[model samples]
Every structure is written in structure tokens, then in C-alpha cells.
Target: MNTAGIGGTDATGTSLRRLADALGTEMMWAGARDRPIGEVVIAEPGDVLADLPGALVLAVGARGADAITVVRSAAEAGAAAVAVRAAPGEDGALTPQVKAAAERAGIALMGIAASVRWDRAEADIRGVLERGAADGTSGHRGDLFSLAQTVATLTRGVVSIEDAAHRVLAYSDSGDEADELRRRSILGRTCPEPYLAHLRQWGVYRRARTGEEVVDVEELPEMGARRRMVIGINAAGRPLGTVWVQEGTRGLAGRTEEVMRGAARLAASQLVDHWFQGDPGARLPSRAGLAHGLLTGRFNSGALAAHLGIAPNASATVVAFDLREPESGDAVSQDARRAEAAEIISVHAASYRRSAMVAQACGQVYAMLPERAAAPSSEGLLTRWAEDLVSALRHHLRTPVQAVVAGTAPRLDDIPAVKLRGHHGLQVLARTPERQVATHTALTASLMVRDVLGLLDRHSEIRHPGLDVLARHDDAHGTEMCRSLLLYLDAFGDVGRVAKDLNVHPNTLRYRVRKAVALAGLDLDDPEHRIAAMLQLRLSREEPGTSPFPGG
Candidate 1:
């Protein structure tokens, strides 16, 4: 190995040979004298003691009978590492004794018989030094290499700054890409002034055209907050735009700052580059108007899909991300500010191999998958992809986000209609606080139960006027649990048994059965009464409570 990499320069071969002779070592060859010691060995002589350390090297001639003697000498010399270097192609002649002796000394012994010249040795020294520098970065040289590999993999398809926008750019090697990711998008349309101002005051404020601070704005808009997350558009610590962060979370604050700085640098560089090259993309249309148009087929899906390289018959899915209400300090209006939001949404969708489109009508964006024969049917896949998208957007946007899905479809033509249906699903989501999806499966399951109850009502002989009232009360109150209890009781008032099967306490179970009986105005022990209660619960589920059941 070239000792140059270990911090040594090439020394005169005659001098080295003289030193070797004085040290009672063989001269080996003429090449050994001129070989460069490009790296300095930091062993300090004490680290090179006779005991076995983590590393050992035993350099020797390729086919000499003294090879074993050289190995034994290195081990005895306290070399923790040993490498047996022989004349080219002499490795196969290495004996088991050499291996056993090295193993017994707890020293690593590698056999390499490649003929080395000054140039080869010098190159080896440089590689060794580079490896030493890498070790100094963290002692885990392997981990650093693995991290670099991962970063390469992650950034593999990253073709442009546009593709890098929403990704957590990190050097998976040195965590550099992580910093790069944070930096890449923080800088927004308005430059260092707005972001710098936001960072200075630590609250939301607007930056005037002249870069003057204006604090009169009630709260920072979502875009402002997002921009702040990306690139603290602050100048002299004064915010050019407003900034808001979750209070008391110092780690998040630091992360936010890192993200802002990285974003600012990337954004500024790109902005300058764009200025020189001339930007070609047009301003985006209003998402609300876009959505309304798409619903009405005013937006040409085929033309847009074709432009995006999507096949006509490919399957797709629509995802709707709903923004959270402005927190205590947010001043952005959803209708007027959506370009950044749309871009973020698009970036995230693209991460999942989904082509993104923000429709204007209901503030919903869809990532449609094209070119596939049949898209995924599971809402879980869509929901997971949506969550990941939202999270990535949040790092740059820092606004509250919620998402809903309309499940995947089998064809592109089905998206607009499916999207319209998805809008209705969004209404249901808005009416509730759940973040889980409301898809065709959930909707169909509820509908099927209702239809079954409708059939029972129509077929039942309960010919009583009060039947309608009983049905409505159960419709309002008797949910899946009540219906389940009625069925269980009908099996026989086997209280202890039903409780065990349902995983509930007996008394808790009895109360529910009694409650069901009272709600239905039926006697549990009576066959006709039990039948009526069952029919009532079933029928109530069918008639949406507002509808009048014909049988009743």
C-alpha cells in the first residue's frame, strides 16, 4: 500500500532500503525504494506495537520461501493488521500456517500478490487517504458509503429543480440532501427581503414592493407561512412576509430555520437562472374555476392527458386535499392563493408516480394515474400516497392539511364523473372530523344495509301505523350495535354467551338488549314481538328517515 495516503511522501528507495536493513528487514525490490508514501501514517509508533490491533499488514515477495517468516515477523512486531503482498500471482501458494498464525494473533491477514509500481502504489495511497478522511466524517465509513448509495438512489430520477421541489433532498450519504431538500423550495417568488423580514420578527407580516415592513396585516397567509417554511424571506431579521410557527417546539423552530435557509438559497439561485434563461410556464388558472370546469367537462381531459403522455384508456384516481382553517395567525384566502399550493400538490402527486391536476371548483386536486390497464382499487394505497404527499408539502408549506379519496377507477374517462362523486364524498368528510377515507366500499356497505332493511319493511306484516315512528327512532338511534343486539337476543336471551362472543360484560350486554326491546316496543320473549322489532330495525335502515316507507 502507498504510505502516501497515510500522510507520507515518496522517500528515496535507497534510504528506505537502508532503514529496512538497519531494522533487519529485506530490501525486497528496486520498485520499493521509489514507491511514494503519499499518506502519513498516524500510528505514532506506539499504535504499531507488537500486539494484534484491529489492522495488520504483512508485505512480502510473491513467491519467496520467506513469506511465512515475514508474516510471523509482522505479527510478532505487534502489527494489529497484516497484509501479505507477494510478487504478482503468488497468493495461491499461501499456506494454512500463515492463516492460522494470523488468526491466532487476532490480526487480519489479506493476501494480495499484484505487482506494484510507483504509480500504482501512489494511487493506492491516495485512495487510502480518502478513506481515512471519510472515516473522520463519522467513524462509520461503511455507513457513509451506504448513505451515499441511498442518496444516489433517491435522487436518481431527479432531472430538474422542478422534480426536486417537494422531495426531502438529502445526501443520504452525509445528510446533505436532507439539507438540500429543505433549501430547494423555501425561497419563493418574492426574494430574500420578504423571507428575511419574516425570520426577524417571528410572526406574519407583509413586505411592500419597496421591501419595507408592514405589520398591519392580520395574519400571515398560508402561502406566506409556506414561503417562510421554505425560505424565510426576511431581510435584516425583518420579515418581508409574515411567519408563524408552533410555539414552544424549539426543534421544529430550528428545522424550520434550516429549511428556510436552504429553500432561500435554492430559490434565489433558480430565480436568477430563470431571469437569465427566461421562464416559459404561464400563470396557473384559478383552481376553483378549473374544478368547476372539469366537473362540466369544460377542461379537456383528453387533450391534457395526451399532453402529459397519458394513454386514453389508462386507469386513474382522484385525491382531494382540504386545507385546514387558518390558524390563529394565518391570513391567506383559499380562493385567491393557490398556485403555490397547487404546485406543492402536483409535486407530491408526481412523487407517487401520479399525474396531478388541481380542479378549481371545490379546492380539490387530483393525481391521476394513466397508462395502466386497471388502477388500484384499494383506498388504502391512495390514502397512504396522499398522506405522504401532504407531509412533504407541509415541510415546505407548513399549513394545516386534510385529505379525502374517491378510490381508484378503471379508466381515465371515469375521472371527471368520479371526481364529481368525490366532491360529494368531500362534503361528507367536511361534515365529520375523520381523516380516514370515505370511498365507494364504505358508501356501498352503508347502502346495502339500508336496502336490506327496506326489503324487510316491505315484506313484513307489521301493518301498524306506529311502525313508521318506531322505525324512525331506531333509524336515528339503533346503529349497527342495536341491530346486532336484536339479532343476538332473537337467538335466545343467552346473556352470558352473547357477552362472551361479543367481548362485552354480561350486564353491559343485557342493558343493550333491554334498550333495543324498549326502542322497538316489543317483548323479547314473544316470537311475534321479536320478529316485529327485527323488521323495524331493518326497515328503518332502508328509508333515509326523510322518506315515507310504503309498507308502513
Candidate 2:
């Protein structure tokens, strides 16, 4: 049959011989090579009597079995053909009885090379069947098929288009000059192993993921190809796939690049359309986009709540996860890692009955969870939930994940501010020792002081009188009196703990605290004065200038 006859003009069905050839296998005994195969099946032992009319049956584990009985049973079951794995270097593996049974029953018998993986063989046969069906119905006029043919005709080179995962979606079949690599890739419906290795070695996958529009490979070793060009098909800055053209001995012209780019754009549209048609929401803005709008205060509370399926006045908490990768990792690996982490988080969050709208933004995955109105204590529950999530993520991913839980927002409109607070918690945690979970409340004082210092015009103005006095005394005397006082107050006057934290003797720390209080003229016994001193001390560390207190 001609190429057009095999995949174009014919409409009956794919023949047994065509299926075997597509799999790169041969018929052991050709009973009826022209018989049309309607479907493919992988049959196990004792399944020979299964109803598989007009289907090509692959009998796995057929070695050392009763071949005659299996073949006759398949034929009785209305199978078009039966294929068995051939033992290496054993040409006469199929017994005479098996051949006679196949011939008498009018069933085609085929032998697949032991070296061919069953999965690849099955995929190849499926591809052939799909092409045959398309041709029989539409006759070389399908969008993807026509695009492939056009690319080949224009460049006079082999063409293949693959999705991001390297699965072959379409390819042009140029008759005689098609190389071995192209043949294998097209038949298996995926890139060949050796070629994938080569691409990885040259960092092609990394460059493709970095949003590069055009990538040129000067040479592909051992493929008998001179050069190749790869064009990335993208939508909304995310890479969809790539179009690859292999230049043969006849080099491509200057205009070939421009033409290929145009073709790539068409292919991208087709891919995106297919994706949207498959999943209706893909055409709409993604959850990430919505979350970003909320974070940037771009959407009103009512609209955002309606979209998120929450009440306008509902309280919510933002849980942010920072998925870190090694500095040496490439962009491709980093993206894969992040995606894996996000999927795990989504699954776990659902299991907890916390239906979260997860989104990726600012190098973190944010899950905005609505708090139940009747819950007694939302913050405590949220903190504990974050701790559990961090533990689960670490156990599954085998890497440390930092989780920051923001305080509950009073209403949906306050989510943007709460998200900012969550990020601030993350920043504070970064300066401390390694921790799995950090809540906004634990760092409230630090955050408040940082916020105040950020607005100060100059560092020379002291925020509190007592803190200023201690600061000057420490600077002049070259002593850690200010540090001792802050630690003493932070510990709630627990001298032993404060001394240990400061790495100093308890008596020394106590003396410094008393001397510092006396020098600053502060009364530590009064609740109001102690609160005022703590606030001033916290602010002093952030900025060396004026006290925020009204009076000395």
C-alpha cells in the first residue's frame, strides 16, 4: 500500500500487516495479513475466550504454554490476530501445531522481538490505529496532520511536535528519507531514550523551560542529521511544548526560521484550544490569577468572595508555603519540584476538610482557607493545622518546607493585608533558627517594631526615654546592659533563663539588669511601665534613635 493508502485514502480499517510493521515486528505465520484490526487488547492467560471480535490480542506470558489451544481460543473469540513475544535467538519458538491452528482458523500470528518493550509496542499500535481512523474518515485533512505535512513540505525535513512531557502529538511521515531516530520516535509516540539523554546533556530542557522562543541545535550525534531547530510553543508565559525540525543534507533557507515560527504560533493556539475544550475552566483565569488579584487589592470583596465560594464577611487565613530548591538545581528541576509539592499540599488540605483555593505567587504556594464561624479559637486551630501540614509535607517530599500562617482576617476584604502579614512572618522566621512553622502572632512585636522603624525619617530620634538612656550607657561603657534588660523583660523576669539565653552568668546578668534599670530610672514593678519599657527596648534594637514614648 502507498503512504496515502496506509493513512490517507483507505477507510476500511488498519490491516494486521500494517499494525505489525508499525510495531517494527514481523508475522510468524501470515494467515490473513490484509484482515482489518478494529481494536487492540492485552490478554492474560486464561483470557483467550474473552470477547474480542476484530481485535488484535497480545498474549503476554505465552512462552511454554499450549500455543495451539491459545491460538484456536483467540480465533474462536473472534480476534483478528494474536501476537506473542519471541525468545531471543529462537526462531522456531512457535510450534507447528500453533501455526496450523492459526492458519486453519484464519487468524494472523505475529512474533514481537523480545527487546521491544510491551508498553512501547502497544503505544505504537494505538498511534497507527488512530491515524488510520483519522485518514479513513477525514483523509489527511485533520488540523494537526495537515500542520505536520505543511512543515515537512516547507522545510523538506522531518518534523515532529511534542508536548511538554515529550510525548509525540503529531509528526510528518516523509517516505524514504526518514531516519531511524524519527521512525522510532514517531512509532513509540515519545522521544527516543538516546536523544532525550543528548538533549538533557546539552541543557535543552532547561533552556526550553526558561521561556526561550527559539533554540537551535547544530548537531545531533549519530542521528545522520546535520542540524535541528526547536521552537517553544507557549501560552501566558507557560511553555506548552516544542516543534522540532531536523535539517537533512539540504540545509534550510533563511526564511525557514520565520516560517517555522509562524507554524509554531498556530500550533500553540491549537494546543491551547484543545486544553480549554477538555477542561472548561482552563479558558478562564486560573486560581493563581485570582489569588494574585486579591493579594494586590485589585478585586472587590464581594466579587472575590463569590468567585472563591465564600461569604463576603467570612473570616479567612492565608497559609503560605515556601518550596525551596538547591541553588545548583536548574529551572526545569525547580519547576518540577514545586509542582510536586503543590499537588501534595492540595491533597492533604482536602483531607482535612479545609477546602483551600491554592495558588502560586511570589515564589510560594498560598492556600486561602475560610474559617468556620462557630469555631471557638481560630488562631490556635490554624497554628496546629499548619504544624501538621508542615510535618506531612516534609515526610512526603523528604525536604524541609517552611510554613507561615497569618492571623485570621476579620473579613474577606482583609485577606490582602493578612497575606502581607504572612510574608512578614516568613521574613522574621528566616532570621531565626530553622523552624517548620511560624505563626504571625509569635512575631507580632517584631513586626510592629519593624513597621514603625520603616516609617521613621531619621535613626537619631529615640523611640522611648528609658531605652535611649540604656543605649547611651551601653555605648559609652562598652557593656551589654541593653541586651540584658531586653532579655530579662522578654523572659518575664526569669533570671535563670535570661542568663542562659545571653550566655552569661546569672549573677552577672542580674547585676547588669538592675544597674541598667537604675541608670534609665525605670520602675519595673509597675505593669504600665514594664509594658512601656518592653516596647521601647524592642524598637531600640530596630533603630538607634528617638523613643516612641511620650515622656521620660
Candidate 3:
């Protein structure tokens, strides 16, 4: 097959020949092939491109004042793309000129800035050309049947998108390295730094905002054995993810790059299909395929739960989160920086056997903490657990992802209530930016408690004995006494204020409150009992309807 890329071979002579043939220019002075461009390219202003004979002479040097004259001379020579070398301090001003000139001349104005290593560039071009030739038969027919067969034949290993950072999307490898790579990236929750750095340099993430594909790969770190990687973006030019392949030193780098590009395009198509399907459930891998595989019954719950001690009576809370990345913005540098800020939640469920059950559900995990002596009163233990969990997740994931605690756990049956609380917590977090952590304490501590109590009042299952009796007695008497009593309690038992609020006499309001206390089977005289009765009444109020809780 036609595979065109520097597959671990000397391409300098060939690159120089290609450049010479394209421009029909003679080499002025051949510098040492091993010498860095900075040392060889900075002889003198006149000596630079002196013997070269071409209308355009691109001086690919590092960005500096020395390259200014070379760039101007190239433009004056009528070269469509007068690319200059980018130095540490140099700005790629030649790009604009190349674009303008290329537009006018109807030719490509590639910005071959010094940012690219010429040696790598030469190998890349050769590799691309060779692969193109191989893919092309006697005619312009691109035969991919063999390639397709090879891809499907994953006896050695299979490839798929695992994660994407910046424009460097990661691919699952087939060998030991690939397995280790996947384990480290997904299970370890480690940052793909090398990939991220490449994207940042190429401004691929930034360019995605404007709907542009990022095709730069010169800076990718050496993956020990020679590996070629290419990342593709979505239709919106945002990185859908990356594709990588390892084709030993047998001149497969170019072929791998071509394959990755094809994979990226395929991945993009899959993404669009996923969007149209509108099934959020389809976006994640099945838990059956995951490490613990709890969701798919690969792991038995009874034994697992028993082993983890996540029994029916264990107190646990459910939490949920919506993770998203910042939108790519204008300015390539800024965009790339922001694109790097994708949020992913890391759960420690992998570290525990039965706990993985929580990890597989709702994309959220659970922790069966040591039992506390008392259920929380204010910002209870459950709420504190949520806070601590969020803190630990942020630290482990190394990203600032937001999570809300849904509810606490007491047993398996509590899942429904916990899921509901999780949903409520998510809602509260969405509406309350300042309140990043959504614990039951935070919810109970808010004015929304009044609203929450009102909701509970409407639920047939939620029966506050003391509050229900008082309500029933008031209803039977055809008196607005319960409302008055609740108002009085809400106002801290202020009779004058309750009477004024009810537009009635203080004596009348006091009589109603006393009647409520007697009917509710509670003592109005005992402070502690009165407080408990008041809280029960508040919890029994009707609440506005939302979705049924998740687990329920």
C-alpha cells in the first residue's frame, strides 16, 4: 500500500530535493543536517537564501527581527505563501499575508512557521504523499477494502475513542501499552498532559469555535515505539475526540495518521447519530463492560452489597451531577486554553467491590460510611458527606466539576428517596450558583424549606401524625384554626402578631392555637415538644411537583 510518512528514516535529502523541485531553487549553503535551524539559518542577512533562485524564498527561521527581511523578500518575490520561521519571541504575522496573497493568486498560502520542526514536516509530507499513492490504485480509485478489513480484524486489539482533551482525542490500543494507557487514563483519572500540550500549541481547540479542523501533530510526544496520532473535531469544529495507532517502525506512521483521520471522521458521524437518537442513556458505555460491571448483573448485588456492607439498613445518600465543558471562544490561544477545561467526575468506586454498585447507577457513585450515632439535625451527616465527596472528587479528577448531594442512605429502599433528594439537590445547585454543595442541611437551611414542607404535605405517604390530626380537627370543625395555629407557630407563638396577621383578636388566635395543640395530641406548654410539632407541621406542607425521583 502507498504509505507516505517518515517511518524512522532520513528524509532531509529527499525534503531538500522536493523543496528544490517545487521552487526550482538551488541550495545556497547546505548546513549540517543535525544542526538546529537557529544555529545554521542565522549566518547573515545577505548570505540567507543568497544562492537560491526562485521568485519566493521562504526563510523558515525562528520568530525574530532577523526573519522580518526574509519574509518581506519572499512576499516581494511574488510567492503566494511567504511562510517564515517562528522564533520564541516571534509572532506569525506572515500568516495574514499568506492568506491574502493566496486568496488573490488562487493558490494555497500555507503558514510553514518555525513552530513546526522542518525535519518532521518533511517526513509528514513524504508520509502523506506515500499513503495517498498507496490508497490510490492505477487510477484515482482509493481502495479502503483491505484497510477496512484490517480495522475490523481486531484479533490483536480493537480501537475506539476513550477520551478527548483539547484536540488530542485518545484511542484504545490493542496491545499491552494500549491497555495500560486506557487503564491509566480512564481508571486512574489522570490528565493526558502530552495530548493537551499539543492542542494548546496548535490552537486546535481555539480554531474549533470558528468551525476549523486542527491537523497539526508535529509536537506529539514520542510514544516510546513510533506511533502516529491524528485528532478530528465535530461539525461545530469542536474536538469530538482523538484516534491513535501503533504501527511498529515498518513505515506505518503515515498509514496510521491516515487511519486516525478516517476514524475521527467516523467518530464525528457517530456523534451526530447519537445527537439525533436523543437517548442520553446511549452516550455512556454499558456498566456491564466496565471494571465492576454492576449495572449488567455481571456482579451479584447480594454478595457484593454484603461484602461492602451496603445492606438494606445502611444509611447512604445519592448525589447527581451534570458535567460540561466550557464553550470554545474566539482567539486561538484563549480558545485552546478554555477547551482544555473539560469536566469529568472520578468516582472511587473502582477501589471498592460492592460500592461499584453506586458507581454504575445514574453515573453517580455511593459511599457506605461508618454509621453515625444520630441522624443529622441541621447540616446533617448526609449533607456533610456530600460536601466531603465533592471535595474529594474535585481533587482526584483535577477538574472543577460541580456536584449536588441528592439524599442520604439508610438501606436499599432508601434509594428512591435518595434519588429524589439527588434530583432536588441538582435543581438547587442549578438555581443556586453560590450554593455549590447541595446537602440536606443546605436544603433544610433554606427558605425553600417552607416550600418543601408544603410539597410533603401534599404527598399521601408522608404523614406527620401531630400535623395531620390538627389539620383533620380544623377541617371537621369548619374553622380556619389550623392555618391560624401554623401561622402562630411560624411567628414564634406571638399572639398579637398572629391576630393582626389573621385580622382577628389576640384571644381568638390564642384559643385556636390551644385547640390545635390539644387536637394534634401535643403539649403547647412543653417547649421541646412544641418545637417538634412545629417542625412536623412544616414538613407536612404541600410542595410543587417536579419529576419523580430518579431511582424511584
Q: Which candidate wins on lDDT?
A: 2
The lDDT per prediction is: 0.42, 0.66, 0.40
Q: Could you give me the TM-score of model 2 versus the true structure? A: 0.47
RMSD score of candidate 2 (Å): 20.6
Q: TM-score of every model?
A: 0.37, 0.47, 0.29
Best by TM-score: 2
Determine the backbone clash count of candidate 3: 34
Stretches of candidate 3 off by over 4 Å are 1-299, 302-344, 347-484, 490-552
Which should have the higher lDDT, number 1 or number 2? 2
- Give the per-residue Cα lDDT of candidate 1 at 182: 25
Q: Write the per-residue lDDT of candidate 1 for residues 1-552, one digit (tens) a residue.
A: 111112212231112233233323211322232222222221221232343222223352323445455455555754434445534345423456666665665444444335453223322433443444333311222222222232222222111121111212111122222222222222111123443465447543222222323222223443232221222223334332222222111223322332223233223322332333432111112333443454456767665555444676667777766655554443455553454555455434433553344554455555444437654446677667666656655554566555657666565656777776666565445544445345545555444544556575567654444445554665687544554555474457777777876788888887776665565566667877665555565455443533322222
Q: Candidate 2 local accuracy as lDDT?
A: 0.66
3 Cα displacement, candidate 2 (Å): 25
lDDT of 2 at 546: 36
| Global fold similarity of model 3 (TM-score) | 0.29
lDDT of 2 by residue, 1-552 (tens): 000111222226687777667656343546888778765566556653666667777666665455566677789888788877766455334656567777999899887667766645664665677777655432222445556655665566778888777766677765665666766665455676788888899877777666535678777557744477888777787777788887766766444565466566556655675545342123223445775677656888778777655667677778888754456648777776676666555544433433355666666777777766566246677778778767756765677788888777777778788888887777666554368888888878767766665555355464667668788988898998877887788778899988887898999998998898898888898887787676666556653433332111
477 Cα displacement, candidate 1 (Å): 16
